[model samples]
Target: MPAVTTKFNEDDTLDMEMFEVNIKAQLDAGVSGIILGGTLGKASTLTGEEKQQLIRETVKMVAGAVPVIINIAEQTTKAAIEAARVAKECGARGLMILPPMRYKANDYETVTYVKAIANSTDLPIMIYNNPVDYGIEVTLDMFEEMLECKNIEAVKESTRDISNITRIKARFGDRLKVFTGVDTLGMESILMGADGWVAGLVCAFPAETCTIYELSKVGKMAEALEIYRWFLPILELDINPQLAQNIKMAEVATGIGTEHVRAPRLPLIGAERERVAKIISDGLAKRPNLPAYKGLSMA
Candidate 1:
């Protein structure tokens, strides 16, 4: 699943037309799933109604070709419950839910928060565990609390401690499907037995991302690593706060997206823009002719 971005107009409103176009591009590129309104999707800034429209439109665009996963990023359990209810209504296949947006709750509070939301809807959930970016760590112990809830289905493992991949696989194995959230560690995560990647740069280079994922999954590391080397510079951008800007820029270069971001996030200015442009442009210049990824298998 490519965790996608929201394209905006200069006035900072939803570029609904580009939004549909981008989703079509993703599907045409053969992505197995699409996740709308996550950290990169700028869900934090979107209003409830906009988010609803986006998810519903996504469900319509997808036409059940692939799973449409919505990120529930509300700050409170009640709001999250409402979001989950909305997702169920919109017919989303899965949800990537954060532990409650700000005000890092203790483990018990966090488990309770997730439990309440899980009970509110039937949509399967991928617990987003990016402690560094999100502050609170959804540790293994907290996951134990979550196991009591059946809807908590997978983990977007962005702990950055790649060893956590090993630990999670050891503990849960098939119980919780694992998808590495950070693009930089995607190769390592797959090698270490992660089920798949919930990616960002795939928005710009879906075929390449899917190729690397398939190569690594099939034990084709040498080829995967070659692509990973060229991809490292681009993947690194996904981890920074400016990812929304960085990815939008790459999308412009790749013809699948635009660089117009919302207010709080201005487009990459002067030097920073130039540097990122150099990386992406240089990458495109030497982009490899990879075999298309056909069978959509994460494992």
Candidate 2:
């Protein structure tokens, strides 16, 4: 596994061509893995068949260059299990699970939710914990309890709480891998002993993300912060749940991918798109030497 260095989220609505382009681009950029149909990919908006196709296409394109992690999220445990099976059948290397939305569940209920998903497949599973999005944060006790599930291999901790990372490292450092889910906290998390980062910003500037991760891995905080500052503005856009949309627009503007997102998660339009474009342009302007913005008409 080589410590599962880098993980990226892909856009679910991208057609096969665009999907292949982005996948190849990220793999070429040297990410350790790809997370298809995750939050950034708008998993909830995708149909079961669509998700399966996306996973299958990604697996074929990646060709084992990097691990492929498929997100299995549905309205029920049964549906999620089915989705997990589809992901495995499609050749995904791992699975990411989110708690069922629309209804708050007790600790016991949460444990059951995770167990059912775990029981569904033998692939390594990583639990996604974002209280703001899922309405529930798996408590430390619950996280520790999840350790009992031999198949559960990782946890994507999205909360800004640094202590949680410390606690998880102190408690399960040897047993389970902990991946920081926030882009801004990546350098610090890596320094604090997280195994890897599941980054949203990597979709647009993977080289920079990889640089930061690599630097942190070797204890070069000074060099890593220099690159981190260059990526901060765009990374800040992720605070809003519409991060995927914003990143898609940046991709379109930077000639990476189309800004077309599925409904209920509309495309950035008018002033919003222009505003994002300006931020990206400004950030690039500040870094004249970085090749990502080379020949890019930031205006």
Candidate 3:
């Protein structure tokens, strides 16, 4: 799952009790791995100490049962390397790193920025390539420069360009694993040969998400499409600017998360809140019992 962040008390402090329970829920439901402080995790507002605390607690809760990837969204090359070092020190198994934050770094600077962070830690890196949301696009040409960074092993393709899935496989082949970062495109990406998914609505529908992936991978396209069609409305929740609030609300409706957010982000209000709640409700009311897959677990 593109894991959600820790719940907060009304005072905006971490609700450690709810947070631990939420972690156990996802693991029990069979999410392959977890992302701590992703975009949906609201990494922008999380403090340095909070990030460390989040990682340490998650590593303990998971107990190496799954890989926990901490996101690095620092603004400068130096800070990026430092944050990478910090994630490594805190026991993160991998990182989902964005390009330089705030000021748009040009090609040369972006390439060196990734190299600096990769050199700082031995942990495998998944490059976050969502030009639609993050401005700087990590094109195939830019990736050519990144080939030297062998530790960089995957790409989170939120470019919303599904064709890039084939392009990357055609070009780099198995050198990099490609994950569909957009929830709406998860099944299509898998069917098109993308390696996996880094999803948001999975915060609310973990089993369905895992089932869809496994079905598509196993050539049960008919079964996969049934779930995907029912899922399109809920999947739409992950693509908007209010994604943090939207996904959190879905989690609440499903009894897995809360809508509380830190400053600069408020809980949904008025019609927006009701509208999202309706979508979650409708999806759950008609939720399907996915067929059991005896294959190796997607998780």
Top candidate, metric lDDT? 1
- Evaluate residue 136 in candidate 2 and report its C-alpha lDDT on the 0 to 100 scale: 86
Off by over 4 Å in 1: 296-299
Q: TM per model?
A: 0.96, 0.90, 0.96
Writing each residue's lDDT as its tens digit, candidate 1 over 66-157 gives 99999988888888988888887877888888988888898899889988988888888999998889898998888988978888889999
What does candidate 2's lDDT look like per residue over 166-206, in tens digits?
A: 99878776687889988778888888899999988677766
Q: For each candidate in turn, give its C-alpha RMSD to the true structure in angstroms.
A: 1.7, 6.0, 1.8
Candidate 3 per-residue lDDT over residues 91-199, each given as its tens digit: 8999999998898999899888998889888999999998988899998988988878889999999999999999999999999899999898999899889998998
Q: TM-score of model 1 relative to the true fold? A: 0.96
TM-score of 3: 0.96
Clashing residue pairs in candidate 3, if any?
A: none
The lDDT of model 2 is 0.76
What local distance difference test score does each model get?
0.88, 0.76, 0.87
Q: What is the lDDT of residue 267 in candidate 3?
A: 87
Give candidate 2 misplaced runs (Cα > 4 Å).
1-14, 288-299
